[model samples]
Target: MKKFLVLGILFALPITAYLFFASGKNNFARLPVLTEKVKDIDQFKTNTDSVISFRDKISVVAFFGSELDDIKGNTFNLDQKILEKYYDFNDFQFVLVLPEEAETRTQQFVTEFNKISESSKWKIAYASPQKVQEVFDSFQSPHKLDENSFTPYVFIIDKDLQLRGRDDDEDDGKLYGYDSSNVAELSNKMNDDVKVILAEYRLALKRNNREK
Candidate 1:
């Protein structure tokens, strides 16, 4: 009887340990912090005549072109899906960084967005063409911008103004990636990633308070 009991305990021990470590690994790899800090964007101005600074808030930044066809699909995704899902999260902001040429249609842009979401959290902003290029360059964007073409990728910026992406470090910092080809899938995936990031920030705050 004693020999049988010892064998049972040995077998269960390894199984329990494996399960514990597997669960820990999954939670650890769930989200990643942007490895690089974004360039200071204080010089960029918002439509409300104020400097754009997301010091303590998570911001979604996207480059918007002036062409109607280029802008329509993205606008629908933001208004119908993203905004509707996170309307109550006051700490979040969506900054639509338009090209210098879009400056002429700023009012029209504001009116259209406001119809979908009346929150003051939405901002339409602009910067010089040179400054805009500098900002996008830091992000390591995949697409090239020609005289009349640009990719419509949305960047996720955290509370500290750092852009979030998959870190190349081999350990466990892989971030969730999405399919940009499908607007619905992209929106849903982005929404989940944002919530995970926010939850992580809250956990860090709790830990710091306990340490103090």
Candidate 2:
């Protein structure tokens, strides 16, 4: 019975991980490629050329569905420790896309974030339902949703702009299907991605610094 229990635990772990990350393995996805003409959180109108294109840099593009309650005190699921140490030191960034209802509220959140951290390390952007549709349409999903994206969902993009891993959200980007089941496990994986991104950035920057 002990041996059986141990084997079961091992098997369960891999299955869960596979369910979470396997979707991003496919190169051709329904999501839209990053584009210009998007507005940053500062209400600045800039093209994609002005921002850090993740072509060679590690990037994270998470489409939040706009939960007003999360903003009581600057709510964000990604750990700040991981963000400050790894993301800030490394060349990491995030795109906090806006939902339909939270346009104004999202802007306020951006302001609050800047008030908290004045550094220009990370960035936030807003995308209308139409723009978001450009992404979801390719996947044959409904691009015209009046509501926001469901909770507990995140998308992980790599340097090559390939969707390498995802926590939840179906093939159609409907919602998250948990691999870890527990909140702590999910949170840890999110942190792991940030740490790896920082490590990658350090190597690149170091190489550049040595060249100089």
Candidate 3:
């Protein structure tokens, strides 16, 4: 009886540990690819001519429309939350795209954000409304723009520039899922999801190096 009980305890411990880690594995969902890549970084006009691309790092992309609305503050807050947690990481970035008309506003917003920290892993830029609309249509996701406004839900674009969302499978972008209305929940989910993709990319990189 003593030997049987010891064996049972050992088996239960490993199973319990496995269950704990497995439950945390689905913190982020693999959404369908939105775009293979951002071909024309030039189209994403910035105050400086510094070239930016999704070729080498994971990016979090979002449409900010006009900066005069409350959504701008909400978006900035969310970005701040994300930066606070991920500022030290060099492999991730955030790009907030605004309408070309918001060029001046975009500059001011970037300046203000940069003031919070001498360094900013996030960037703000503008693009023609037509180009912006093209990206939204490409996603074919209604959540790209709020039904009632031009503000958009945030999106994760992998190192390969594929758009992602928190959906188990592609739902024609209808994976119009999750709520960012709550800042705390939004921050936790977004941070964890980003970590998931980054982890997967790093693992792939390791495998490729080993193969070579």
Candidate 4:
């Protein structure tokens, strides 16, 4: 009887473990795409004069407009709560879109930001106010930019240039962007969503390698 019980327990353990992990994988398989084919950043000019596109990269995008000082707190909240955590991940970046007139201010903002954290993965792009409006409008989200062409919220763009967010959020039924000023939102909701997307890509890479 004891030997039979031991054999049964041993067999059940692997099955139990498999079920547990399988359930977890299913739960986080992929983040739902809220918007498809968001406008790429190729039209904007970067400090390095290099083309920045949304192709094949996970990006956290924000619009600071021309007033960098105004959004300093919001930027810091996003940096500490989100960017600092995922900046080192492969093909993951923070894209801050600013108006063409804010070049000097943007440089100052970058210098100040670098004093506290690494800004290598933070790509700053400049565009005309008209172009900025065009790109923001491409999101098709319910939220709108403020008078300064700025918003406290930041959006998550997947590798395929699609927006990813919750369709059944408790507060906003359809959450399109996270408020950078809200640390709790960033720490709780945004962090989990980012993990889901990153895991989705990692799993894809593994499967592709296996097939090869």
Candidate 5:
């Protein structure tokens, strides 16, 4: 009876440990996709006449509108909190969508920001006001753009062009965007969420390679 009990304990211990670790990995939560198939930004043109699209990149997108002076501080806050941190990630980018009229202002802003940090991965796309509204509307989020077509909030867009955010967020039930002026929200919530999404993709890539 004693020998049978010992054997049962030894067998169950390893199985229990395996189950515990495997469950941790399998249950790792991904940042939820709040909206699906967001409209791509291919219709816009960059300063270099290059095309920018959301097809295969994890993008942090913002709208600066034509009044670039108003959001200068907001842009800096985002640069320090988010862009400076994840700009080096292979498929990660910070894309600013501005009205075509803001081209000169955008250039000066970019040059000013570059003096502080590398801005190569910071892309600027210019489109008409109507077209900018068209793209923003496609997000299907509850947030709204101001009369100037500017929002102090920035959004996270995944490789599939889907909006990624918390559905049961503590502050807002559904958090569609992060307020650029709020440092705490960016440092804590946005920082952690970005890490989660990046890790999610890395794991997926590893799985694909293994299958191949």
Candidate 6:
């Protein structure tokens, strides 16, 4: 019994540390800006005209779908309303992205939203399933793989193509979710996380003006 107990304790340490630390470092290391974006519309319809590059400005990418009847009300509707409301606060583009499979459902959702409100705050688009997976897989977060892999997830990439905040990081550092998804999905509780990034962006603009 004593020998068995010692072996179990030894085995658990590496597994536990990997789960808590190692994988998260890989996720944090992935630069969100360089990832190719996919949307819910067809190729021809996708807004490739102004395809946002990390070189231009910071961007907020939210994966949204109303197709899953189970989560539409709680997750989908709330996602739209949040983007529409606080959109005026920053210059960053807030985009609505859906996978090819979610097209019909997303179209209906977008149309209904446009009817109820009038704003250019959100731009909707479509992308391929494989492409979306490629973006998420690069982070290799197993927790994210199980659920949000094929659906809506959020990522905030700074001008340098670094992923700063994510809804789900490996663990809470400084007890914060300072990730893109939290700001996109939760909207209220952790908005200051988003504000801090924006504040930095503003300061850069000020510095640039002074340099001129």
The candidate that wins on lDDT is 5
* Stretches > 4 Å off in candidate 1: 1-30, 146-149, 167-181, 210-212
lDDT of 2: 0.46
The sequence of per-residue lDDT tens digits that candidate 1 reaches over residues 96-146 is 766667777767656776676653566766677677777767666454444
Instruction: Kindly report the root-mean-square deviation of model 1 from the true structure over all alpha carbons.
Output: 5.3
What shift in Å separates residue 192 of candidate 2 from its native position after superposition?
Answer: 2.2
lDDT value for model 6: 0.49
Cα lDDT tens digits for candidate 4, 1-212: 99999999999999999987755432544777889988887878998868888788999999877888888899889989888988779779889887788887777788888988786568988888888888889889988887678988899998888999888788898999999999999988898888888888888899999999
lDDT of 2 by residue, 1-212 (tens): 99999999999999988876853332223233333222223332222336434455555544555675553322343434234454544445665555555666655565666665532454554456565544433223222333564333444455555443333334434322212223453455545554544555567669999999
Task: At residue 111, give the lDDT of candidate 4.
Answer: 86
Residue 188 alpha-carbon offset, candidate 4, angstroms? 0.3
Q: Give RMSD to native, each candidate.
A: 5.3, 9.7, 4.0, 3.8, 5.1, 12.6
Q: What TM-score would you give candidate 4 relative to the actual structure?
A: 0.87
What TM-score would candidate 5 get against the native?
A: 0.86
Candidate 5: stretches off by over 4 Å: 1-27
Question: Candidate 6, clashing residue pairs?
Answer: 39-126, 39-127, 40-125, 40-126, 40-127, 41-126, 165-179, 165-180, 166-179, 166-180
Q: Which lDDT value does model 5 have at 78? A: 90
- C-alpha lDDT of all candidate models, in order: 0.64, 0.46, 0.62, 0.85, 0.86, 0.49
Least accurate stretch of 10 residues (summed lDDT) in model 1?
Answer: 169-178
- Between prediction 1 and prediction 6, which has the larger TM-score? 1
Superior candidate under TM-score, 3 versus 6:
3
**Candidate order (lDDT):** 5, 4, 1, 3, 6, 2
Q: Write the per-residue lDDT of candidate 5 for residues 27-94, one digit (tens) a residue.
A: 36999899999888887889776889888999999987889878878988899988898878988988
By TM-score, who's the top model here? 4
lDDT at residue 188 of model 5 (Cα atoms): 81
- Per-model TM against the reference: 0.72, 0.50, 0.75, 0.87, 0.86, 0.57
List the pairs of residues colliding in candidate 2.
32-135, 169-175, 169-176
